[model samples]
Target: MNVMVAEHIGFCFGVMRALNIAKKTKERTDKPVFTLGPLIHNPQAVHELEELGIHPINSLDEAPGGILIIRSHGVPPDVIEKAKEKGFEIVDATCPFVKRVQEYARKLCEEGYRVIVVGEENHPEVIGIIGHTGGKAEAMNKRRIPVIEDRDRIGMVAQTTQSIENLKLAISYVVERVKELKVYNTICNATYMRQQSTKLLAKEVDLMLVVGGKMSANTSRLVEIARNEGCETYHIETKEDIDPAWFSGKITVGVASGTSTPDWVIKDVVEYIKNL
Candidate 1:
């Protein structure tokens, strides 16, 4: 069997910047270093940071006083203020793309538009973006377009990892129902590249393998895209998740990974496939 890898796979600029900030913070601080959340979506990467003395904490109460690194997903401005009030040093590692979305949401809210965040409601990034709107904004997916009255003016911003198709669909749903609509295309360029590359590769391969953390939204999006292309696709975090049975009678295997995925993880998956 032959192996084909997507042109755009593995860590993007934002994830790399966050990882570097975490590592440097660890090197500089003796006070326990803790990320407000997993520094990135990848468990393996977070585990590696723990080994280097950087830990992930879900809440500020978990640490009495320590350096708090904001994950790439970005947190609410209030979160940073609270961490400061608790005497924790702050290292903001939020992705620039996500930061832009939050800013746009805040601006939209300040301008009196009914803010609609186009993304998963429960996602940390979406939560942070809503917070920027001072809790006035609502998050919605393609399946759940929020109710907008004909008199309501709507302002929209999407999760950086959101698919373009879903964003477009949500916009279409809102435009006809509202008095006016303003949208900021906040999806990351890297996300578009990765999704497009995965789609192209999936069309030419017999089997498609997506590697990244299970909780990674971008990774899951790739799996959805590949499956929609009618290719047999499996999402895995590591080589251990690979099943030889899936490769039976397969000629060409395509490999794609989320932006949070490290190069080493992708290399390991590719090596395992070559051996198989």
Candidate 2:
């Protein structure tokens, strides 16, 4: 059997940056370091951090007082204010591309364009993008994208991990109803590359294996993309999760991973598939 791997699988710049910051924070202080959420979407990575005494807490109320690491998915501004009020040291790891979305959304709101965020409504990145719009942002999920609202002007931005095609579709939907429309293609470059590479590999392979945390938005999207292309795709967290039955009679396989995925995980999966 043949195994094809994506050219752009594994950690992106933003995720790497966030992880590095987390490691340095762990080394610099003895105080408890807590992440607002999993610093990255990968469970293995989170477990690795936990081993280093970096913990993930869901709420600000449960956070420790030492150092709070804001995830790559930027949090609301009020969180920053409140964290500071509690005297917790802040280590921001927000991706620059995400910050760009926030900037565009804020600008649109100030100029009177109804801020339209084209992505999942409750995604952490989507939440952060909305917070930047001064409460004027309206998030359009997969369901909401179809219903064009009654608005004169609309400004658009997407969650960095979303497919560009979805953003364009939402833009097309709004073009007719809104007198003026603006779009910031906020989909991260790495994400687009990963999607494109995955699609290319999926077409040639007999089966597809996607590796990353199930909770990861980008990883889940990869599973959906591969399956939508008519390929038999399985999303797995580790090599142990692979089903041998799924590989029966398959001559070629394609593998791809999310941004938070580690190179070692990909290597291990590739080896496992090759041996089958």
Candidate 3:
């Protein structure tokens, strides 16, 4: 069997930047370093950081005082202010792309347009973006389009990891429902490239493997994309999740991973396939 890897695989610029900032903060700080949430979506990567003395805390109350490194998913402005009030030193590691989405959302809200974020409502990134609008923005997925009045001015920005197709659907739904519509394509360029590469590779391969954290939205989307292309696809976080039975009679395997996935994890998956 041959293994074909996607052209765009593993960590994107944002994830790498967040990880770098976390590592540097650990190296320089004597105080306990904490992230309000998992620094990134990858559990393995988060575990590695814990080994280096950077830990994830669920809430500010959990930490008495220390350096708080914001995850790649930007948080609301109020959260930063509250963290300051709690005496925690803030080290923002928000991805520039995500920050842009938040800025657009805030701008739209200030300009008298109803802000709608195109992504899962419960997602940390989406939640953070909504907070930027002072809790005025509502998050909507393709399946759950927000109701808009005919007289309403609608302004839309998508979660950075959102698929283009979903964004388009949301835009189409809102445009007809509102009098004036403004939309920003906030999907990350790297995500689009990865999805496109995975779709193209799935067509030629007998089996497709997506590697990344199960909690990663981008990774889940890759799995969905490959499966939608009619290829047999399995999402795995590590080599241990691989089932040899799935490879039976398969001649070519295509491998793709989420932006949060690390190179070492992808390398391990590729090596395992080569050995098989």
How far does residue 61 in candidate 2 sit from its true spot (Å)? 1.4
lDDT per residue for candidate 1 within 66-133, as digits (tens), equals 89999889988899999999999999999998999999999999999999998999899999999998
With a 3 Å backbone cut-off (N, CA, C), the pairs that clash in candidate 1 are: none
* Model 2: per-residue Cα lDDT over 35-58, one tens digit each: 999999998999999999999999
Q: What's the lDDT for candidate 1?
A: 0.93
Compared with the true structure, what per-residue lDDT tens digits does model 3 show for residues 1-276? 799999999899999999999999989979999998999999999999999999999899999989999999988888899999999999999999999999999999999999999999989999999999989999999667677899999999999888888888898888878779999999999999999999999999999999999999999999999999999999999999999999999999999999999899999999999999
List where candidate 1 sits over 4 angstroms from the true fold.
none
Question: Candidate 2 — which residues are off by over 4 angstroms?
Answer: 146-151
What's the TM-score of every candidate structure? 0.98, 0.97, 0.98
Q: State model 2's lDDT.
A: 0.89
**lDDT for 268 (candidate 3):** 96
